[model samples]
Target chain A: MGKNVLLVDDSKTMRIIIGRSLRQAGIDFDNIFEAADGIEALEVLEKETVDIVLSDINMPNMDGISFLREKSTRDAIKDIPVLMISTETGDDIIGEAKSLGAVGAIKKPFTPDKVNEVLGPLL
Target chain B: MEIQDKMIDATKEIFSTMIMMEINLEEITDVHGPLTDTITAMIGLAGKRKGVLAVHFPYPVALAITSSFLMMDVEEMNDDVHDAMGEIANMLGGNIKTILSENGRDIDLSMPSTIAGSEYSFQSDKDVEKVIISFSTEKGSFMVEMDLEK
Candidate 1:
């Protein structure tokens, strides 16, 4: 069965592009939820069952790192894997995401192949 | 790699992968005159390097990119076009920031802003190092300018 996925990003265009790339990567999802930021993503989680999350690091009103930290403390959603997608190449940022229970990270301007490579085993 | 090369590569990659537009570097030149009938997006960077990165698109080029990005025909440069342009700048600036930070420069990017008009002009501060590069696609041409105070 396809997994349920949640996409969090402030940019509408980026959400669409990431959705397209996910499909192109052959990672089918039973349900794909979209949120403008981490705050909205938590709202989505309140009502939906998400098996994985793909989020961008920078956003207004709750960024991805904060979301990961929040998700890490929640028993209901803590097990669901989170993958960060951002243009941030800082080692410290990536390390922080990893410590917060992010399964992996994907840099921006990612191709379908790169997406598949990072998410294939996890999904 | 040099900063200019990194910016060029980031622009090419983002346009090609995200927007599905094949863009080639045309030339790297000095800052130009006022851009009429254009849309511009700017994002600021702070920390180890303080600067602003701006992307300027002619109306036709902006329309084409907006259409491709939203998967609809954008005849007029409206809010959607403005948002699309801003997102493009954010991605471009974000990628450039990552490249710089990886090479030993720490930088933080600010939220992007977009403006669409025909009569405005863009000028950088005198102390900043300005690098302007022009890129061409089949649809039209645009420029990416980076002004950094390192």
Candidate 2:
């Protein structure tokens, strides 16, 4: 069966760009789910069969760090790996994200090759 | 490299990689007069440093950029244009945050916003150190300005 991916970002433009980048990288998924923020991402995770999540760190309702922390506590959805694709890629922030259960990160202004390099291994 | 140079590189990278447009640095100036028929996307920086980062794009350039960014033809100034420009500013702001703050936790970035009009002035109320870099693309030119509190 093909894998599914969830994209969580506040900017609609960014979501579209990420989806495009995924296709450009030749990463195809059966389902490509989207959420505006961490809250919506959590809701999608609960309802959908998402294999992995691509999330942004800064958002309006609920940010990625809080989302990872909250998701970790839930038994049903905690294990799904989340790879942060954001502009906030400082060691301190990325380290904290790792502590919160994020599998990896791809900085903003990234290319399809960069996305593939970082995200392909996880899949 | 200096902050201005870093900003130039960051802006170029964003345009090249994400927007699929190659832009070259045209000029580095201290002041630019009032804008006309343009849109500006800005983001604030707080905490360890306090200031703003803004990108100014004329309607034509903005339309071209939004079109290239989404791989769709954008002919007018719409929400998609605003959002795309805001995301560009947001990405530039994040790069600047990394340049200013080592850990990235020291500086907090505000939500990105947009301002569009026929004419307006963009200036800081408080004393600031400003750097404005102009860039040119096939469609037209745009400016990236950074103002940090002294």
Candidate 3:
């Protein structure tokens, strides 16, 4: 048993890859949960306690940005550290994610080792 | 005109450089039917150029490719590997978008979509000036389709 992590993304494929990366990285997390979009993620929070959130920035309905925006206002979800992962590497998006309280940001096409680098200290 | 060519080239480079694979279309007469073992990554090209850029690959090859790229062993193709296929497509589209500005084309991109099923044809609506570049790995068996519309 290790820390609990909430993985958010619209693609199941990506979740698997990221999950594999986490395991390969040896983050030692227990009860890995996943949400297709922010709306579902919010729902997961109601009953589950996640130590960290590894999320993608783009999604349908409630995207990563909107999720962060809304989550910032919620006292319960706000304190939980979020790591933004997506293909968009624009400075503006990074700035925005940082402002929204993302503990870290990693670009897409990322290796599992990169996941470790981002989550090592925090999680 | 060059922007389109450049985008095509970018895709070719990715498959060759990252996957250690190359694709060709000289004998691809029927680009239809089922590619059951195919791995695909699809991403949207928005803004001035709006459409989707997808990478089509054979299943094991995709798993093999991503596995090698990530340094992991994916015995069975799962949702995560499939999603990585899509993200790879997204990355190809995103990088090409960067070069569009120089050619006077402004574009916004959307997330990628990855699909792994059997027997499907990915045909583009527009055929006029429509571009489709193919790449094949030196030792791998598959093709990458860059179906982009301007």
Candidate 4:
């Protein structure tokens, strides 16, 4: 079966840009899902069969750290790898994310080449 | 390099990598006049360093940036423009935070917000050390201003 990816961000513009970057990087997916925040992301993960998640750290309703904490407790979605695409590149924050099961991260203001460099290995 | 130089580099990188537009540094100043027919997006920095990062864009430049961002033609100021501008400020704010704080735990960044008007003033009532860097794009020019508490 083909892999699917989910994008979680509050900004519609960012979601569109990420999707565009994925296409520009020649990373095609059978399905691409989206959510506005961690709560919506969790809901999508529960309902959809997603291979990976690309999320933003700062968001309304539920932020990325809280989302990781919440997702870790659920067995059904616990194993799904998440790669962060955010402006938050702080060691403390990224370290916390890695501790919570995030596979890796891509900083904001990144190029398609950067996206490919970071996300290619996981795929 | 000074904070001003870092800000300039960050702004250029954002424009070049994400917006697919090359921007040249116009000037660096501590103050600017009132804005007209422009949109401003800002993000707050709290915790160890209290300040705000703002980006001011004229209507044409903003529309062009938004258009380039989405790879579509944008002729009007809409939610997409606001969101795109806000995200730019967010990214800049994150970069500023990295510059200000080494570990990133000492500071916190507020969600990005925006204000647009035909005419208005952007100033700080509190004492601040301000640095405003202006840049020019093919469409027009814009400014990135940072106000840190003194």
Candidate 5:
């Protein structure tokens, strides 16, 4: 069985698109999780063991940043590497995510190659 | 804040970050207003200020941007073109909503809608200022043209 991964974003369309990308990048697993936003993602986290987190920056009710902060304090969740995918690209936001505890950053409108590049080493 | 400034800032932010392209804003003399966009993605914003903000792209430019953005080749504009344009607008609008919310003018954003057709011209109403900010991406040229009023 491949490693379990959790994908988080607000848009259903995006979630589906990214989910397909993940499959194409050889993330063949039945345990792949999806969440509408960070809050819901946390709920999923509390129950299951996720190998890595792929999240979008812009989401409602506790954004990805807040989720990263919360994940850092939890002993069970802290070890999982997080990859931030977003449209809001700036040095500040990327730095903040890294400082707050994301393993890598990928900008939006991504290709399969980029997705594989980000996930290849960690997963 | 003027809608024009809002447009310049947001468009620059999105295009530069996502496409790795810089946009130059030069006002066109033949302002097509709302209809000037050969390909337009618009959404209804309701709140203290209610209006539609459309991101318009020319046919070839639209195809190029959409192809690069989605990592696919688009020979011509079709349903996929409309969906792609709507998504691009959604991104720009989503960022705009955040900016507007911070300024204490909150609004709900409707899903993006697109219009692509031949032989169409859009001119803003007389009271409203129809501003066109011209930009060239690595792919081609496009504009963020709008008609709005408080």
Candidate 6:
């Protein structure tokens, strides 16, 4: 069975690109959910059975770091792995995301091979 | 690698890897002129280094790139074009940010903003170090400018 995945990003274009790349990477998902920001992402988590979250770091309502922090505190979603997919390139930010319970991080303009390599073990 | 080289590499990689478009370096110019009938996307950088990065695209180029990125035929400047431009700027700025970080400069990237118009010019602070690199592909041509307020 495939895992259920949630994708969070403010840009609709980016979401579509990421979805295409995910399929190209051969990461099959039972169900794929989309959210525009952290707040919306939390709402989706409330109703869906998601196994993994792929999120962008910068968003309007709530950013990825804040979402990860919130996710870490909730028992229902705490165990689900969060992987940041963003254009942020600071070690400080990446470290902070990890501390907040993010399993991994992928920079923008990412290739399908790189996505698969980073997410294969976690999913 | 030099800053200009880094920027060029980022642009090439993003276009080819993310958008599946092949791009070639056309030239690097120091000329500053008003961009008419063009779209420009900008991203701010802060922390150890502070500045802005802007990518300028002629209308045809912007439409072509946006269409390829969205997997649709974009006829005019619309929401998809704006979003794609912002994302492209973000990706380019993000890669450049990583190179700076590796060199021991801690930097933070801001969300991108885009502007489109028939006539307009950008004026930066006098203290900034500005570098502009131009590129072309079968689809069209564009320029990427890095303005660092040192």
User: What are the per-model DockQ values?
Assistant: 0.53, 0.89, 0.21, 0.91, 0.12, 0.63
For candidate 6, give the lDDT of residue A113: 96
Q: What is the interface RMSD of candidate 1, in Å?
A: 2.4
Chain A TM-score for each of the predictions: 0.96, 0.99, 0.95, 0.99, 0.94, 0.96
TM-score of each: 0.94, 0.99, 0.71, 0.99, 0.58, 0.94
lDDT of 1 by residue, A3-119 (tens): 899999988888888898889998889888999999899888878989989999888899999998998888888888899998775778988889999889998878999999999
Q: Which pairs clash inside model 5? A: B35-B122
Would you give me the overall lDDT of model 6?
0.88
Comparing 1 and 3 on DockQ, the stronger one:
1
Question: Model 1 chain B — which ten-residue stretch has the worst lDDT?
Answer: B98-107
Judged by DockQ cut-offs, the docking class of candidate 2 is: high
What is candidate 3's lDDT per residue for B106-137, written digit by digit as tens?
Answer: 56677677777766766677642344455455
| Backbone atom clashes (below 3 Å) for every candidate | 0, 0, 18, 0, 1, 0
Write the residue-wise lDDT of candidate 5 on B1-150 in tens digits.
Answer: 865677787787666645445678766433653444388888766685556667778888888876765667888877767877776777776565655554423566666788877657655454654566778766667877555554
Residues B15-134 of candidate 4 have per-residue lDDT tens digits of 889998989999999999999999999999999999999999999999999999999999999999999999999999999999999898999999999999999999999999999999
True contacts kept of 6: 0.68
What are the TM values for chain B, all candidates?
0.93, 0.99, 0.73, 0.99, 0.80, 0.93
Error of 2 at A114 (Å): 0.9
Instruction: Give the CAPRI class of candidate 1.
Output: medium
What count of clashes does model 5 give?
1
Predicted candidate 6 versus true structure: per-residue lDDT over B63-137, tens digit per residue = 899889988899989989999999999888888788777642468778899999999997685688889999987
- lDDT, residue B137, candidate 4: 87
Q: Where does candidate 2 clash, by residue pair? A: none
Where does model 2 exceed 4 Å of error?
Answer: none
| Candidate 1 lDDT, B37-87, residue by residue in tens | 999999999888788999999999999998998788999988878878888
In candidate 6, stretches whose alpha carbon ends up further than 4 angstroms from where it belongs are B102-105
